[model samples]
Target: MIAPELLSGLPSTEELPCSDDTPVDNEDQNSLPNLLLFMLASLWAERMDWYFGVDMAIYHTTGEDPRIPVVPDAFLSLGVERRKGGRSRRSYATWEENGVVPTLVLEMVSHKPGGEYGAKQEIYRQLGVLYYVIYNPEFWQRDRHQPFEVYRLVDGQYQQVFSTAEADHPYWFPEVGLGLGFRQQRLGGIEQEILVWYDAQGNPYPTPDEVQLQLRQRQQELDAERQRAESERQRAESERQRAESERQRAESERQRAEQLAQYLRSLGFDPDQLPEQ
Candidate 1:
């Protein structure tokens, strides 16, 4: 932890720029990170001790200047406020956050490289980050690196822990209690690749769209069940009415026979002695 006297002189997050004003080369640079952030929001809805930032500047004193920030495509800091002081964070300052560095940082390679393997890696290493992820899907051949790579800080050095070749996807991070992986999915009527979170068993968590589809399916099933029950009740009621009508017809015939017998007795005729017809 930085000394109190040293932290007192540092600039507040409000005074720092939110980012370095560098425009992304492609839409994936922004969309992918935000997708991860959204997934985390759903997965950890009940938890209030984590914060995920997308393309946000992170200020720390480990570098040559506290003012200079290293902006990752995305970063996750555990044991920190989801919202700082009941308000959205303009920027993340390590000093303001009680020296809580980000546990994980993600960098997505775009058409142009932005030092994901060299300078930024060193920066995260100096900041004591636990995990660093580099996602280079399109330009991996040019960069001579895997499309997806996960590095774990071991003995103050970042070591390659997992890659796509290992086929152990949705690699679980025991420290963070989450897994990271990618899959081919069609978004907005176009098929593309997307990174997704996974459970300890490597089951990918459903997106919000998937959740809505599941809810709709469940509702439709319930509606069908209700219709079947109503149909059964109507059929039972029809059978009961038919049975009552038959009972009434039999009773009418018995009453008519008794009346006829009474009339024959008045006329001095024995109805029982009459020949069968």
Candidate 2:
């Protein structure tokens, strides 16, 4: 619990800077979080009770210096605003956000080492983050860990919840109702390995662009089916019209033959005695 005095002394989010003026490890480090945010916006398009931060400072009073903050590569908080009170958040202060800490945090390791497996892990544990993920795409061998790792807080400790058998995709988190997994997907017109969100059935949640593509493909299929049905209907109608025309022609020929026979009888000649034409 935070002391009342400490809470009072904590700076307002607007008064603090949004970021710490440090650069991300690489483009992937910067884009991964944003990609997740975009995907969530489409997945939960109606809900406004969540906030996902990319490289944002999370100021908590738990540490020695309340002014200092631990900035995760990405962080997610439930029961928070899509925007802070319908306004952009300058920084995430636990006290300001109704004492809500991040439920999930992610860290991506790069060429230059960040302590994702060391100090940062401990910090997230102490902050009571329910889940911590470390994505070491480039330097996993050096760290002696897999490219993707997920740890769940259990009994006041983080337990690694991944095995070699499930290395491609990890277990689902019921709290968030999403799963973290690695798959090769196209982003920004490039196909590469990416960390993606999955559902309970182990289906990856598509990006906004992918969703659009899917909708378009479905529409095209529907249109094709409609066209096929119409073509079949037209074929049936043509066959019916041909049959009707044939019947009318046969009736006209019979009428003409009866008229000729009547004329032959009037002339005192039997039409049935004539040669077949």
TM-score per candidate, chains pooled:
0.91, 0.82
lDDT by residue (tens digit), candidate 2, 135-238 = 88778889899888889999989999873324457568889988887777787789977777888888888877688889999999999999999999999999
Please give the lDDT score for candidate 1. 0.90
What is the TM-score of candidate 2? 0.82
Instruction: List candidate 2 stretches off by more than 4 Å.
Output: 1-8, 163-167, 207-210, 258-277
CA lDDT of every candidate:
0.90, 0.85
lDDT of 2 at 230: 95
lDDT of 1 by residue, 214-238 (tens): 8999999999999999998999999
Best by lDDT: 1
Runs in model 1 deviating more than 4 A are: 165-168, 250-274
